[model samples]
Target: MTHATGYAALSAESPMAPFTFERRALRADDVRLDIRYCGVCHFDLHQARDDWHNSVCPCVPGHEIIGTVTEVGPDVTRFQIGDLAAIGCMVDSCMACPECVRGPEQYCVKRSTPTYNGKDRMDGSPTYGGYSDHIVAREQFVLKLPEGLDPERAAPLLCAGITTWSPLRHWKVGPGSRVAVAGLGGLGHMGVKLAVGLGAEVTVVTTSPAKSADALALGAH
Candidate 1:
């Protein structure tokens, strides 16, 4: 086991405070990462506060994670030590399920293992998250940080970015496609950028007329 330190909410009413925990020893397909940046998603706040009524205490909540590959297990082949990498909301899943094989592991029939506030598939140990010094995850759930993207700015892409990008890509949004992003929030802004980037005719639908300039600046028509 590897010792790790991070901030955690000890209870629903508690503020995040320094906490220490153990990361499981490397499994053959695992890659260990030294965390660099972790995006603060609203889900983290909700989980920390037990707003969903399902949070575990000492919840260390963060899922948009960017890190450096510090070590790779014997069977790991996709990453090398010192590579920039990332982990999103999921850490593992039963890959034999039809959903997993078809490509949406989030719908894994056995239920995908979340990055935190979840039970490890192997040991049933409560999984801690990326607001930590280091983390161990299966290589299948890790992504290679693209070479030119800035890690700090790219962190949100793991969650907010992908959340919007997936559907845009699924619908084959492209030149001549009309895309309407609903707001200028985290996910909305990303949707606009992605839709515009994909050559779509993007529109930002907002209740605030003052945001018109901001929306236009973001490439929304």
Candidate 2:
């Protein structure tokens, strides 16, 4: 086990505080990364507050993670030391399942192993997230961070970018498509950017008209 430190919520109502825990030793086919940035997802707050009633105590919440590979287990081949990588909402999944075979490991029939607040498939250890300084995950779940992208700005893309892109892509939004994004917050702003990038005429519907300028700046119609 490896010692790790991060801020965690000891209970549903407790504010996050410095907490110490242990991470499992690397296994074959594993990649260990030194976390550079971890995006704050809405779900992180939900879990930290036990909103869904499934949170584990001393919960460390973060999923939109960006990092550089520091070590690789013997059998790992897709990455090596010094490579930039990322892990989204999932750490593992049963690849043979229907949801995984078709596409979207996030919908794995057996339930994808979440980056945090979930149990490891093998040893059943509580999965800790990227709120810590480091994380270890199977090579399959770790994605390569593309070159030329700003690592800081790109951190949110792991979650926000994909969350919007997937739906638009699945629906086949294109040049003539009409898209309307509600709200101008994190996810909604990304929705506008992606929809417009795909050539859709995007309309951002927000409660405050003051956000109109920001929406247009993000490329919404």
Candidate 3:
């Protein structure tokens, strides 16, 4: 067993404490990462407190991971040592399934393996997450960190950026199109940024007028 250290809540309602556990050794398709800075998203709270009823005890919580690739499995052709990479909210999935075959494991009809607090399909052991010093995951789940972007700021884009891609594209909005992004939370902020990036005139709808300036400051037009 590979040893690892992370912060974890011993039980629901308890503060996260130091934790040590075993990580599975590298497999033919695995990539090992030396985790850099991980963003603390608000969902951390929900998962820590069992708000969604998906909490796994000794829960080590985090998914937005930006790191340097330290090792790659023999069959991993996409990345090599010293390359910057990212692990999002997913780690593994049954590649034989239709969704996996299409290259969108997030929509895997059999359900993709989530980053943390998930079960490993092969070993039947619990999978932990990115709130740790390192992670070893199958190469398919790793996203290449763009050289142009700052990894710290780019971390949230893994989960946040992908969620808002649909609504904007679904409406076929483009230059001169008026778009409305509701709310100002993490996901909402990503929505505003994306809409503006796509050349849409974006107005963020918020019950709190306090967020109006923030929305505008974040590139919402």
Best by lDDT: 1
What lDDT score belongs to each candidate, Candidate 1 first? 0.96, 0.91, 0.88
**How well is each residue in 1-221 modelled by candidate 3, as lDDT tens digits?**
57999999778879999999988888999999999978787787788888899889888888899999998889999999999999988899999888799887888888888888889888978888889999999998998998889987988887787778776888887899998888999899999888888899999999999999999898887
- C-alpha RMSD in Å of predicted model 3 compared with the true structure: 1.3
Q: For model 1, give the 10-residue run with minimal summed lDDT.
A: 180-189
Whole-structure CA lDDT of model 1: 0.96
Number of the top-ranking candidate, with TM-score as the measure: 1
- Superposed Cα deviation of residue 131, candidate 2 (Å): 0.9
RMSD of 1: 0.9
Q: Per-residue alpha-carbon lDDT of model 2 for 79-107, expressed as tens digits? A: 98999999998899998998899877888
Count of clashing residue pairs in every prediction = 0, 0, 0
Candidate scoring better on lDDT of 1 and 3: 1
Candidate 3 TM-score, C-alpha based: 0.95
Candidate 1 deviant stretches above 4 angstroms:
none
How close is every model to the real structure, measured as TM-score?
Answer: 0.98, 0.96, 0.95
RMSD of each: 0.9, 1.1, 1.3
- 153-181 per-residue lDDT for model 1 (tens digits): 99999999999999998999999999999
Off by over 4 Å in 3: none
lDDT, residue 97, model 2 = 90
